[model samples]
Target: MGWFGRKRDPQDANEMLRQYNEAEAARLAGLSSGSNLAPTTVSASFSSAEFAVEDVFTITGRGQVVTGTVASGVIRVGDRIVVLRDGADVGSSEITGIEMFRKKATEAAAGTLAGLLLRGRVDVARGDVIRTSASA
Candidate 1:
C-alpha cells in the first residue's frame, strides 16, 4: 500500500482499506466495536515472530465439509482457535470453542481458495470458499 503510505498505522490503513471496499460483517461472527471489514482476494499466512503488534500477517485454509460443520469447530480459513481434536465429522459434544486466528475477520468469501487465517487450520479440505452474503 505504498500509494496509501500516508494512511499511518497499519491497523488504521487496514481500516481504511475496509472503509473503501466495505464488506458486510458476519451476522453471527460477533465483531468488536469500531470494527470495519473489506473483502478482497489475496494470499495470506501466519507464523510465530518476535515483533510488535503492528507486524501483521495472513493465513489461509480450504475444505468441503457441510456448512453446518464449519460452525461446529471445523476451523475455517481466518479462524483463531486451538485444535483439541483431529477427527472428521466429529460430534459437537466432543469439540469445544470456536477456533480462530483473528478476532475480527475481513473478507470471508467462500470460494475454491480462502485467504487469511492466522494459524491456518490443516483440516480444512480443498475447494471451500467462505463468501460474503452479497450479489456480485
Candidate 2:
C-alpha cells in the first residue's frame, strides 16, 4: 500500500532512503573531523569595562542604581560611564557608589554581580550595557 493512501514507486522509495543515508553519513563525517569541536580560549582581561543591566531603579536620596553582572574589566566609584543600547550611546553618568550584597565597595571587577549607584539621572533601562566612558 502507498504511504498516506498515495501511489508510491519502489524506485522512488529506494532513492529517498539512499539520499537520507548519504546525508547522515556526511553529517557524521563532519562531526568526526573536529574542526568546529576545538575548544576556544577566552582572555581574562578586557580593554574596557562592561556591565550588563539586569535591573534599574532609583534609590530616592542616593540616585539611580543599576544592578547586574560585570561582563568585563573593572568599574570603580567615580568612573565616568556611558549607557549603551543596541550598540548606540544612550546617555552618560558617573558612578557614585557600588554595592555587592548590600555591602559598599570601592570597585567591582569582571564577573561580579553588583549594583552601581549613579551620580545623576540618566535614561537607562534593562538590557542596556554600561561601559567605561571612552572620552574620560
Candidate 3:
C-alpha cells in the first residue's frame, strides 16, 4: 500500500504548521510594538496634515466620521482642518477623534488609513481632500 508514494507523517506536518504560526505571531507582535523604531517629531511650524477622503459617514453620537488614507504629514485629534473640493473650501472642522483598525489612535501618520471624527458642518464627500490650515 505504501509503494505508490512516500508516506507523509501527520504529526510532522502539524508540528511544522504550528511552528509557522508561532513565528508569524512573533513577527506581528514585533511590528505592533514597533521594536527598534525611531520616533518622528513634526516641527511646531509645520503646516497642517492632509488626507484624501475615501468614505464619509455620521455616527449617531460621535458626529461625522471621515475615513481615508493620510496623504501627507501627520494628523491628531483636535487639529483643525479644511475640507476642499475643486480647489475650493467646502468648510472647516475640528477633529474630535481618530481611529485606526478599530482602535483609538493619538496620531495618524502619512500612508496610514484612519477614521477621523470631525466636529463642524463641513460636508465631506468622496475624493475631497482634507488639509490642515497653514496657520493651525
The number of the candidate with the highest lDDT is 2
In model 2, the Cα lDDT at residue 131 comes to 89
A best-first ranking of the candidates according to their lDDT comes to 2, 3, 1
Q: Which stretches of candidate 1 lie over 4 Å from their true place?
A: 1-93, 101-136
Q: What's each prediction's TM-score?
A: 0.17, 0.65, 0.66
RMSD versus native structure for model 2: 15.7
Best-to-worst order by TM-score is 3, 2, 1
Q: Please list the C-alpha lDDT of all candidates, in the order they appear.
A: 0.27, 0.81, 0.79
Instruction: Please say which candidate is ahead in lDDT: 2 or 3.
Output: 2
Tens-digit lDDT track of model 2 for 2-89: 5679785567866886798688557645755777852222222345688888899997788999998787789999899988887778
Lowest lDDT 10-residue stretch of candidate 1:
47-56
TM-score of 3: 0.66
Residue-pair clashes per candidate: 20, 0, 0
